[model samples]
Target: MAKWTTENPAFVDTWFSLFRLGQTKKQFNAADTIKMSELTFFNPLSSKDNLKIEATLIADTIDKVFSSWGAKLENSISRNTAINDMIQILLDEDKTIKDLAEKNDENYFFTNEIKLENES
Candidate 1:
């Protein structure tokens, strides 16, 4: 079977998630994945559109890692800028999106059991 692609994006519940972090080692660790998965900052179920991501960019959020990405999907320019700005986060020795999300989330959104896809 083919892997999931952006053209046919997967819709995920805000309560649980499994996403890969860039530049990070994919070696699974139970506690670390839990911390990353629990972050409300990256929750895909946002009702917010044209989001100003900076307000949420504090201690434990993806925006903190890419502070230049202040605007959201407002326009092609903004989208391109934000996407380009994201490249900075991949720089070595810089704090990562994984670092911020794993620090602690506000937990304002959903909270429920998150299990590995392989689990029965």
Candidate 2:
């Protein structure tokens, strides 16, 4: 099994720390800002199934870590864009859809009338 081992785990931790700072009116550091920006640009692709699974697991891990602090893993685009470009790419690239459905429960249609709601 693949694992997520970052060069700087503190960088990932600092990104989550921003949510707390935002809630408490504390100032976020410059490094935190840069790390968050770097994380936003990740777009991995692979031909091997194992690599794809590993990548999806990593993305899911990041999404979960941020979500614990009330931050959502949204696309790097304005909400008013013509298409949800990042989400489409994620789906096409075999990234897990469960995270997206969990975050956007209101938008997921399970049946003609019943939308699958996330209990989270």
Candidate 3:
């Protein structure tokens, strides 16, 4: 089983601390920054599975929480571009889609989607 584990206390503390801060702020702050040293241990380029899990969690939250708030988050280009870039980086590292695919017992799939057409 692939799992994400970080031994860095500073990284975990700062992340959740900022998340708590954002939960109370009336205006969104985009100036949040991270230290390079702190980020080095969890580099997406060096940890494909970690990046995939992070991306999936962000996606799941957006789908379950933000989908009903006007526009669905999955329709945003920036979100898709970020995930796509991660997928490309994983491919560059020789990680196949199958390796990242979510498993269902004995089977695995990249994704499952349903598109409804308009009946006019």
- Using TM-score, give the best candidate's number: 3
Please report, in order, the local distance difference test score of every candidate based on alpha carbons: 0.28, 0.33, 0.31
State every prediction's TM-score relative to the real structure: 0.24, 0.27, 0.28
Model 3 error, position 16 (Å): 13
lDDT of 2 at 75: 46
Error of 2 at 114 (Å): 32
Give lDDT: candidate 2, residue 35.
Answer: 23
Model 2 per-residue lDDT tens digits across residues 1-120 = 112222323233433433333311223333322321123233343345644454354444544444464543234433322124223433343332222323232222222122212432
Taking the tens digit of each residue's C-alpha lDDT, what string does model 1 give over 11-58? 121111223323233333332323323433434454343122522232
Model 2 TM: 0.27
Error of 1 at 2 (Å): 35
All candidates in order of lDDT, best leading: 2, 3, 1
Error of 3 at 42 (Å): 5.0
Candidate 2 residue runs with Cα over 4 Å from true position? 1-47, 73-120
lDDT of 1 at 60: 24
Task: Give candidate 1 regions above 4 Å deviation.
Answer: 1-77, 99-120
